[model samples]
Target: MTARKIIHIDMDAFYASVEQRDNPQLWGKPVIVAWRGNRSVVCAASYEARKFGVRSAMPAVRAGHLCPNAIFLPPDFPRYRAVSRQVREIFQHDTDLIEPLSLDEAYLDVTENKTGLPTATQVARTIREQIRS
Candidate 1:
């Protein structure tokens, strides 16, 4: 059987990363993007905030306690959706076999990619580098 090459990419703390990317002030800060309410849950926590044990699905108040210095911001779904589209477009450029798990994650089947890369790992690395750039 022929090998079916697959590549998975997941953006770290997607919402928080978008926030930080768009706002210089948020860069390097522990950020938690979620709703604001007594019963609210975290949506995304930046790596900086994760250092203090903050995580998604955790209660907002608990996350605050875990990272006292963490900055809480409400999620902007529209903005996230827009960015997700952009990422999808990037994937579409290489292959049509893209499956998105979420706005920040996806699987790409690149066994026969347009770029003619030698290996799936190379394709994955290129895609990641493109996203990072």
Candidate 2:
């Protein structure tokens, strides 16, 4: 039997991060990705907003009260999907054994990687740099 080396990538607050990246003004400010309504749920919240206890699946109304000054924007799914595809492309540069969990998360089996990175951590680190670049 052979051991497997796998790396899990979860981009926390992905939607909120994208929002901040796309709009420079939102950077460093609390960001909550949700519509403004009692019934709407939070899709994502930035670390800034998380400081106020906001979280994914949380009620938008509650998140609003938690961080009143937080930038609230409905999710931009199309843009997120595009970025997801790009991220997948970066993974392919290292390995083909990718198991996508969502637009912001995935698992990559790099036991026999294309990059010959020698270690799973190195492969993962390079992948992270590629995604950020």
Candidate 3:
């Protein structure tokens, strides 16, 4: 019998992270991905925005009220999806036993990995390094 090694990886604030990475102007600021309409809600909030109590599914208006300095941008599904695919590719370098839970999250079975990492934690470390570069 063999023990199973499972690893869960989540891209923090996926949309906002990609937005910040692409737009230098958004760096080091509160960023919220949401439509600019009265009825719109927040799709994702960067860590800076989260510090101000902003979060996913919250009313955009309220988010603005909570963080007046937050830069609000509409959700970019195509870009986000592309980034998700890239992340998946990174995961694939280590293991094929991946179950995607969301655009930003997945579960990986790393008992046996293509990368030959000693453990799931090492596999995760390599994946994170790849994603950052």
Candidate 4:
């Protein structure tokens, strides 16, 4: 069997990242993507929010209590999907052997890639540059 080069990309705090990307005011602040309700749960929490002990799957009310200044926003799947597609496009530019696990993560087999990159690390760097650009 041929060896495989698997790269796992973490679309870290995806929902919160998208929200921050779309709204400049959310930058450098605790951002939580979840509804504000007694029973609502956190869909995603930004790194800043995480510092305050907020995490995904946590109750919205508890998140608030943990970080009272945290900015809460409802989940936007459409925009997330669009951004996720853009990310996938970047990955596809390097390899086609991609297995999507979720909007926030994926496994990419880059043992033999279209870009002819020397290593999976290089491919990941290129993908990150493309995403940033």
Task: Give the winner by lDDT: 1 or 4.
Answer: 4
Q: Give TM-scores for every candidate, taking all chains together and pairing residue i with residue i.
A: 0.96, 0.97, 0.96, 0.95
Model 4 whole-model lDDT (C-alpha atoms)? 0.92
Compared with the true structure, all predictions reach lDDT values of: 0.92, 0.93, 0.94, 0.92
- Candidate 3: 10-residue stretch with minimal lDDT: 115-124
Whole-model alpha-carbon lDDT for candidate 2: 0.93
The candidate maximizing lDDT is 3
Per-residue alpha-carbon lDDT of model 3 for 18-47, expressed as tens digits? 999999989999999999989999999999
The TM-score that candidate 4 achieves is 0.95
Clashes of 1: 0
| Model 1 residue pairs with clashes | none
Q: How many backbone clashes does candidate 3 have?
A: 0
Candidate 4 lDDT trough over 10 residues, lowest sum:
124-133
Clashing residue pairs in candidate 4 are none
